[model samples]
Target chain A: MSTTVTQDMSFLYLISSASVLVQLVMLILVLISFFSWWFIFRKLFVIRNEKRKTDDFEDIFWRGVDLNALHQRITSARYDSGSLERIFAAGFGEFNKHPAGSDLDAVMESTRRAMRATYQREMDYLESHLSFLATVGSVSPYIGLLGTVWGIMNSFRSLSSVTQATIAHVAPGIAEALIATAMGLFAAIPAVVAYNRYASSTDQLATRFESFMEELSNVLQRRAAG
Target chain B: MSVSALRNSSYSEPRILLAGALAVLVHLVFIAVLIFGLNWKDQQPEGMMVEIWTELPTPIQESVKTQSPPKQIKPAPEPVKPKPEPERPKPEPVKPEPAKPAPQQAAVTPPVKKPDITIQQKPDPIKEIKPDLERQKKQEQERLKELEKQKELEKKKELEKQKELEKQKELARQKELEKQKELQKQKELAAQQQREQAAKAQREAEAQRAAQQAAARNQITNEISKYKALIQAKIRSRIVMPPDLPGNPIAEFSITLLPGGDILEVRLSRSSGHAVFDNAVERAIHLSKPLPLPPDPALFNEFRNLNITVHYRE
Candidate 1:
């Protein structure tokens, strides 16, 4: 059994050594394909939950609820992935830290800083693995093309010894080469589509966070001044 | 915290990790299978066979006849001696009748008498005569030495003949070498002459090209000077100063005119601090219509869309 395993491994090693560039390209494609599927599934769930939480948070926020009560509710839950909730938490925490009747400028500056920090964290979460998705989308096709070029080179090398080259002789190699390309597209197309969709959603959420921070800061400023 | 909520959060990380690991494993297995298939398909024999011989044992390989007893065949016959003279004389009277049959009978008779007598005698004294046979062999050796001396002389003659053939080949080779050298010298001389001729031709061509370029440049310069004068004259005649213009301006004003001698646009390329003076110069250019055209077409081509620089002085 061990010898057979070793034999199989050495056989693979021979193929890899015969065309290292193709093997490397295929390896990279496989890795990208794996990671792409992982991210696609993971992000699908994450982004869906984020959308739901954000919508629920927004609804509650606009329903004439007391700001302090909303802060308590968000703090108690603790795992809120919503962008608006984080922004609100950051601003409210800073607001509570300062003494009552502090100057409006000092209060607003502290709130803005907190909100900015939280905004960065939210954006980081939203953009996680997005760059990997982007890399996969852009590089997979070229990687697949590299495999195709190497396979064609092998085919031509075979032709030097063969008197007659028919479709049967060439087709399997071409088919295997094209499998890499098909897998690459399979990995890339969804990644690209998902990236675009997620990026837009992230941007919209970011805008919402910014606007909420602005409104919250104004409200705090007015309270301090009054 | 709710049990359902806590369970969901806890399970998410493991679920994601498991899914990621499974995906990676699947892809790795797929790649491994692909590579294995490719290798199995492409495998080819690489080594060649070499033959080697082994010797059999010497004793066993020897002929079996060498170990067996010797066997003998019957002795060969000897030649018949001529009959004695007495017998020949007696047979002469009967010979005519027998002579015709004698030749035919001689043809049929086998000469086996010598070996027959040796086989019959078996003499011990004749066995002792073998010692004399050795002495007779020494005498034969002397005869062979004389023959060898004659053969040596013949070999010397043959060596001379080989030497003559070698000398002829050497002479032919020398002639061939001389012929090749002569041909090479002729080729070199012809090549040298051709190179000198080509150089001379190239020098003449270069000189002709330089002379043509000089003439062309001179013609162009003369044409440019004529056109410059013609353009200056046309401009001086056509340009008109406005009555309201200042006597002195700080800077020179350059105005561009279009084809047909109409002012298409004007700009203060150099701005005068006095805006009114600059404006007046611009107005003067606009008022000047259909400036005088150069009579020569070559001059006109140069002066078309002319840029005029006017300096105002107090």
Candidate 2:
């Protein structure tokens, strides 16, 4: 029992002896897991920053800070603005472009257009590569299954020439096959969990940006009317 | 300008490269942990584990010997002492030598003769008791002589009985010897008879075996001929002998057969001078289809090719 179990159950041993196709599958799974982790971390930081900056912008905006002063301060700073800040910046920047005597409807129309464009662009940045995470989570196991199927097929293919087969004869191949699946799950579980978590956070941030846009347009309309 | 910068920062190639490099570092750490941190040796339970399980200390088994009942010890016999103490008075007899020394003074020391007289009186009593002792000793001697004579007579009678018992044993021994000699003669005769019977049985068995072998050989030869005739008969039955074509014709065809007896080829080794007779023989062999073969597969090789001479007249 011990001899058969330890035949190729070692991590390095399994990796080294795995068939080419299963090895490739394992490589792909590891790459997916790693690359997805990268996105997960990057999005984690980006979405957190957006949420923080949006909250900060909302607090100051409600504190009755002068709009022109606020806009100037954000534009002067070299840092990239959050989704909400960028939408506000775009509207304020577009509003400042019009002359004092310009048609109010025409001025508000162009400002809304700028904010809308920035909103979409900012949300696009937040949601970028999220589909890759979803794909990794949803499809990685099947890809791993393909590797397992191929490995088992190879083991059985080698077995056809043999007159008798024991567990020791087939264990290594099966173990290597299961390694693919284990790696796939390792890649997929975090990806799925992160995707669910980050997708929800991004959606929440998008909702906040949309609400801020509506409030900003209303305030700008009052300013233009006066 | 700030908004444009912000939009470009989100999809920056440098950020992706940095993230990918960091991910590579993470994967390396994971691989290292899997390689170095995993204790591979402890995972397997080896043959040594079974040996360790039986390593408990063994208890020594002491053999208990059954004790024998102690013998009743007796006092040992006392050693005998030599009895020569009565000769101690011989030294006192030396006083008579000192009496001889006083011979010159014998007449003058006549008053000292009283001690000599007492000493002389001491031997008188010893002399007087000696007669009684001698008589008692003579009587004891006679009694010993009588007991010795009786023991001698009993010993003579025992010797006579022993002689008689020896004579009877000698007679029985001779009778046993004769009985053994008779039994041995009978055994020898029985062994002789058995030897003769064994020789006769061996000879009969040899003859029967030889006859059986010859019969089996003849049966095999007869069976072979019967089949050969059968094959020849089948082909002959199919033959339309060319009637009245010429002198009595004969055709010999060497036919090749498969294991299933399918005729492979029929070559005329010794063709009849008449072409019609030879053609008729060839046609008959073809019509026979699969020729009859012996049931024995061993005979198949013999039928691989067979030469059968057909007498057209017959």
- lDDT of all the models against the reference? 0.61, 0.73
Residue-wise lDDT of candidate 1 within A1-226, one digit each (tens)? 2223223333444344435666677777777888887886677666666677778887887786888987877667755436668678778878888988667687789889988977786677767888888888888888888788787777667666665765545544555466557667767887799788878878887787788788888877877777
On lDDT, the candidate that comes out on top is 2
lDDT for predicted candidate 2 compared with the true structure? 0.73
- Which candidate gets the maximum TM-score versus the true structure? 2
Cα error of candidate 2 at position A214, Å: 0.7
Cα lDDT tens digits, model 2, B1-314, are: 76687566545422556666776787788777666643354255343344445542111101111111111011111110111222223333543454444443443444354457446644654664576576655564555466446545654565565556555655665565567556555655565556556655765686678679989888777777887899999999998877787776788999999988799998999988999889998999999978888788886777788999998776
lDDT of 1: 0.61
Which residue runs does candidate 2 get wrong by more than 4 Å? A1-8, B9-42, B45-314
Q: Estimate each model's TM-score.
A: 0.41, 0.50
Clashing pairs in 2: none
Candidate 2 has what TM-score?
Answer: 0.50
